[model samples]
Target: MARRRRKSRGRKLILAVAALCLAAVYPLQEQLTDGGGDSRGAGNAAAEDVSAAASDVFRDGSTLEVHFLDVGQGDATLIRCGEAAMLIDAGNNSWGDDVRDYLEYQSIGDLDYVIGTHPDADHIGGLDVVMEAFDCGTVIMPDYEKDTQTYTDVTDVMEEKGYELTLPQVGMVYELGEAAFTIVAPNGEYGDNANDYSVGILLEHGENRFLLTGDAEEDSEADMLDNGIDLSADVLKAAHHGSRTANTEAFLERVNPEYVVISCGEGNSYGHPHAEVLNRLREMGIKVFRTDEEGTVVATSDGAGITFNVPPSESWQAGEPKG
Candidate 1:
């Protein structure tokens, strides 16, 4: 596919450098992201995967921006600090070009890191397109595999571009300008369920931190809890698009985020941002933002404080139910 580009919108950027503090690296010459339920497999290992890295050593107080794009029912997040930019996921296959447009709109043609999160189409469907369009440094994804065309598209595009898939190991840290983020989960193994293998991370930009778990369900959450990494954060991206199967009581208690963002499409059939999850978060006194209702959400941090582009919602509104 021919790469597309928009008019040059000069963006001042500073990309990140990942420090893989790997205990065990899974170099997948083959693998995949499409998440729904928990995939059963190898759970976790000894608690030693929680080693400290660059994230613990950096705190220069530079500006960090996180954009949570509203890709209908999928997930995509863009993180930019200084001149460096990273993308977590890209909606569905049909939304690939749209994602590329969004990136171009931000004046970003080079991505330092691209994380597929898991083998879920909603999370990686557009990745192939984005990967083909931009000069991406490192591509990160869970060690999960799938035979779907969506998965093949991503790997095929990487092969075409001569890039390698860098599977994330727990405690891996990468520096982005004045910011840094650490891989926190998939600390062990999970069978075939893509959701359980979701690449979870704890991003720290000075004192402000954000926790994001692709579509990880309860099983993955349990493993993460046992991984021994600090789960507390100023912000969190609810797993499984805020499905009750995820955002477990124990997991939420551990995270204790002041704010939570749910990236599901409006009136999605899956009933994302389910009532059970929303009520739990509100009762816990956490503010919430949902792409279904907010379009796109943006958060800015200056190492000490965080501000959102729009006022957060405390609504108990739930999504459409699956018949």
Candidate 2:
């Protein structure tokens, strides 16, 4: 009778241990499901690994700073998050010194990412100078190349600096400190036009977003919209300096940006910031900032909201939208 009682107690202990083990595994199994209400054992390891890796990112108390340098009829934006810095374009050749000075003033020690957007002279003309002035980790550009001197100058610098040029592809994500940016345009071939092949970067800082498109026209914009890429942004860098060829009504409606930044020279021969685009922005009640009108536009974000160098009262007002 004593032996039988001992056996019963042992059985109860084993059952309790089994119950605890099962309880611990249940939550993990549910989290590792592969979506069809099925959780396979092999996927558990991968799921846990991914979760651990993501945990290291998006830590609390991170700030992002963006500087839209007034490179005069060209685009040059410097984004800095912690120790990482990214430069999108460097303006025209004539503006090389200015862009370099601005970077220096910002105390940018090195450039982690340098994006040319396209091979256009206005976009990348000063990049060679920038590369010469500072150490660059990666250089990104469109797949298409032009035979123009501007393109040659940029490539020459890349070769001289022993930097491998990366042609941006759609859906590629890059990290800048706690913030991240994704390439959302030039998904595929864009034929002959360099502007149409422009690279678009969607920068994300916590809940805030900024879209920068280097001279991308309607065709590229349409493709991005059709691909279901998130075109919505808090601030948008106007395409082609706010030309009529781009920024169609449909594109504007989809992006629905609260503010637009246009990079163009004052009294530029191209007549940028066209009346059509201005009127559309007005109708949407969106605020507009122009490099030509406001010098350099600097916006800082604390991962939740953004504050610009210039006040809202300084923003452009086109009065009314044409019927």
Candidate 3:
């Protein structure tokens, strides 16, 4: 009887060990199924990846000029400091050639940073063509991955171009010449809504600051406020194409921007630059420029003050002083 009991006890111990092994394997299996290997090391690995990929792109400088391209009905922003250049959100796929022409017009052959604020087609669709036309130093995007064709096209181009991609994390700062571009929102975990998941960037140069809000809605804006981030800026990119769902009055009070740019299409389906949002900005005494109305808006800063340049024939609207 004692011998039989010892054998049964040994068998139970073996079964317990087997169960533990399965439990360990299950997490790794889940990670693999999700895509690539476990993300346990993704955080640590991302820094190195970004450094390696972008090491060749940026150059030190003190002056910077950002062009909020007038890609009708979509968003496409370009940043240039000295010889380094960065492209953020390439508009819609139909605007691919237009984006390429704009880059060529600016003589931007090599891109230090190619940022897709989110996976939405209107924001990232033209990236495939841009990537094909110019050499990219590094591609930064939000953490969430969608299975859309635009996403696939962008990924395929990245693979084809041998470029490594890194997701923009909160507090991650990229120094470009004399300016510091920092990711200020969409930190930690992914938000429930895609618009709320938008990546927000704060570009600082000396005393000048520009806040780029990538369609981030009120929920994300609340998160930013709760975190006590310095939302004040000299210039603001109106969120969600200036939709009624974003740019709350409370959030605007914190930003208190001198100038605001709204990137939206002419007679868009969404009726962007909503009347309520416009009224709020107007109340704050902030100057507003819309791509639909103002061709391409360019804001140049020399560390202390900023100047606005609207396409010829277009007059400055509310806040801009007559030159």
C-alpha RMSD of candidate 3 = 22.0
Put down candidate 1 lDDT per residue, 209-282, tens digits, no spaces.
Answer: 99999998899899889988898999999999999999999999999998899999877888988889998998
| lDDT, model 3, position 203 | 95
lDDT for 197 (candidate 1): 90
Q: Give candidate 2 regions above 4 Å deviation.
A: 1-61, 313-323
Better of 1 and 3 by TM-score: 1
lDDT, residue 192, candidate 1: 73
| Candidate 1 overall lDDT versus native | 0.76
* Model 2 lDDT at residue 177: 89
lDDT of 3 by residue, 1-323 (tens): 11101111111211111111112222223433443221112232343444334323422365577777777678999898877889999888777666765576455779999898888888988888888888899799888888898889889888887999887778788977678798888754645577777788999988999999798888888888887678889999999888889999998999889888998876677777787888888777777777766556667777887765442212233222223
Error of 2 at 112 (Å): 0.7
Worst 10 residues of 2 by lDDT: 1-10
Clashing pairs in 3: 61-177, 61-178, 73-265
Question: What local distance difference test score does each model get?
Answer: 0.76, 0.73, 0.71
Clashes of 1: 18
Instruction: Give the candidate number with the greatest lDDT.
Output: 1
Total clashing pairs for each candidate: 18, 0, 3
